[model samples]
Target: MTKHNNLQSISVRIAVKTPAVSRALEEIVSTLDGFEQQLDEKATQTDVLVLEVGDNPAKEFETVRALLEDGVVNQVFLTSAKTTTDILLPALRTGAKQFFQQPLVFQEVQQAFVDIHKERIAGEGIAVEKVSIKPGKMVSVLGAKGGVGTTTVAVNLAVSLNRLYPEKTIALVDMNRVLGEVTVFLDLQTEFNWDELVKNISRLDPAYLAKALIQSAPGLYVMPAPNSIESGSQVSSQVMKQVLETTKNSFDFVIVDAGTQVGASAFRIFSSSDTIALITTLSLPCIINVKRLLGTMRLLGSIPMNNINIIANRFEKKSAISLEDTEKMTGHSVYSTLPNDYQKTLEAINTGKPLVDVAKNSQLVKSLNKLAESLIVKEEPVVKRKSWFW
Candidate 1:
C-alpha cells in the first residue's frame, strides 16, 4: 500500500456499488483535485466501475463480463472479502484491470487512479508524444521440432551480427514461452526475464526496456524467457506483440528464438517478424514436420513464402537425403545448410561460447557468419563482402 503522487490536471469518473466501498473511494478521490465520483448504480458513462463481490463471486463476475461486453464500462476494478486466486483469476479474465481486498488499501486504490488517469490522458492525446523510432528488422528463428539446433543458430547469428556491425544495436529474445535456454546457451545470468516486463506491459517504454535487457556481449542484449513453466502461460499474444513492437523500435536488429511450440503467441511473433527462419534436419520425421509447419504458415498467410528461409541443420556432404531432395519434399527451397560438425558444436555449447568466439576458422562458424551476412540490410552495409555460402 504505497501512496502515489496526486495527478492534478487529469479527472476520473468512478462509480461504486457498495456504500462502504463508496465511502472509501470518496475519501481517496478527495485527495486528488480533479477526480469525480458518481454513486448511481445505473450510471452508464463512467470511466471505472468498482464492483464488490459477496458470497457468490462467480455470479458477480458474470455481471462484470456483461458490462464489459455491452460496452457499458471502460474499466473494471473488483473488491471482495475472498481474494484467492480462484476469485481473482476469473475477475481478470473477465476484464477486471485491478483488484482490491476488503477494507480497501487506499494506496493501491490511488495507484489505480493514477494509472487510469494516464491512460485517459494518453487516449485524449494530451500526454507526451511517443518518440519516433526508426525500427529495425525482426528475425524469428523457429525449429520444426525439438533438438534441431534452434538455439545454436539463434545465438550464433546474434553474435555474428554484433561482431559484423559494431555500431548497430542488436537484441536476441528467447520467446520459447516454456523452458527457454537462450540464457543457458550464452551463459548469461540475468536478474529479470520477459515475464516481469509483460506483467507491467502498459508501462513499456524505451527506458524501461533498456533496464530489463541483459547485455551478453558488447552490442548484443538478451531477453531470456522465464525459467518456470507456469510463468510462460502468464504471457499472452497481446503482451508478445507489445514486447516485440517495443524491441523493434529500440534496436537495430532483433532476433527471436521461437521454440518448437507454435502457439498463439508464437504465431503473433511470426506474423510481425521481417524474416522467419525455419530450421530443420534431413531426416524423414523432421522433413515431414517441416512440411506440416510450412502448410500451417501458408494457412496463416502473414509470413510470405519468400520471407520464410528454410535452413538445414547438421547437414552432411554425403547424407541419405540431399538438399535437392529436401527442397522437393518440403516444397520450399533450402536457404542454407549448416555443416554437421558434432564435436566442435558440442564443445562450443558445453563451454557456453559462441561458434565465432571459440572456433572462428571452423566450417560451421563460417556458414553461420554467411547466414548472418544474408540477414543484414543492403542499404545499411557494415562492409562490402561477397556471398560465398549461397
Candidate 2:
C-alpha cells in the first residue's frame, strides 16, 4: 500500500452534522491519509473517520457521543450553518480536538491536509512503538491488610496525577466495591457506579468511560464503587481486563484501588500495570505480606523486579524502622514515605476533598506529589542481565 493523500488509511472517522457537510468534508479529507467513512467503521480499520452529521443533530450528537465514548474517532471536525454556541460546546465538551463554525475553510482545509501530511512524515521519523491504553495507565493499588489506608493513597495519588498531568488522562478505580469509599473521600456524588459501566461493557468507549469516571480535574477521572451493594457487578478478572483494556486506549493512566482479596481481576491488573504500588506500614505482618507478595510476583514473573515500588503510608520520623532499615528488611527501596497527618487527612476525607485542595502544602500531600512526579517523568533505565556464572 503506497500511503499518500488517502485519509481512509488511518481510520479516524470525521463526522459532520449533515449530509452536505459530510460530503463537503469528505471532498476535503479524502486528500489526507487515514480518514475513513462512517459506513466503513465496522468493515475497515478507521484510524480517523470524517462524518457530516447534519442529517440529524440530535442523532448526530448521540452517534458522536457513542463514538467518543468508544474511543473510535481520534480527531473530529464540527461544521454547522450559523451554529449556536450550544451546538459546538457539546462536541468540544466530549473532546473533539478541532471544530469549524463556518463551512469548510479554504485555509483550514489546506492546513488540515498539511497537518496530516506532517504527521505521516513524523511517523516515519520516530521508531517508537504505539503503546495504546484505552483510557489511562491502570496501576493496581491494593492493601496488605484491611486498614492499611489503600483507598486513601489511591484517591490522593489519582488527584495528584490529575493536578500534575492536567494534559493527560488518569483514572482512580475503586475495586473494593463494598467498602471502597473513593467517592466519599473525594466528596463526589456516587450517582453512577460500577454496575452502570459493567452493563455497557460491550460499548465501553472513551466518551462513556469519561462519564463513568467522575472528572475530578481536566486530566484525572475517578471510577468509584457502588453506593449500595444490593445489585453491583460481580467483576471478574476478565471484566476488569476488558474495562482496563478499553481505559488504556483512551487515557494515559489508570489507578486501581484494590480493597481486598487480590484474586481474579485484581491479580491480573497488578501483573500487567506500568507500576504496582504496595501500600503498607511498619506492621511486621503487613511488611511480611508485602515482601511475600513481591517474592511471589518475581517467582511467577507476574511483575518485573524493577517495576515493584513499596510505599510506606502514614509514615513519621519517629517510626521504629528507619528508612534504611525498612529498605534492608524489604530488599526494596522505599519509593516515598507519606507522613501521618491525622487531622489533615481526616478532614479531607470527611469533606471528600483532596489534601492538595484542602491541605495543599502538607508534608503528606507533598510526598504524594513527589511520588506522582516520579511516576510521570521517570523512564526506565537500561539494565544489564545477570550472567549465569555470577
Error of model 2, residue 341, in angstroms: 0.9
> TM-score for each prediction?
0.66, 0.63
**Model 1 agreement with the true structure over 301-347: per-residue lDDT tens digits:** 88787888999999997989999999899899999999998888888
Off by over 4 Å in 1: 1-131, 380-390
State the lDDT at 365 in candidate 2: 85
Instruction: For candidate 2, write residues 1-390 as lDDT tens digits.
Output: 235543325444555546666676667666644444456536533445454446456677676667766766555555566445356445445444345545556555545544555566566673334433233446777787888888888898888887876656676777786756887887776466666667667646554564456666666667777766654446667877777776666666678888765666666877767787788887787888877777777777767877777888888888887778777777888787788988988889888888898899788888998887776534542222211001
Candidate achieving the largest lDDT: 1
Compared with the true structure, all predictions reach lDDT values of 0.79, 0.67
**Consecutive 10-residue window with the lowest summed lDDT within model 1:** 381-390
Clashing pairs in 1: none
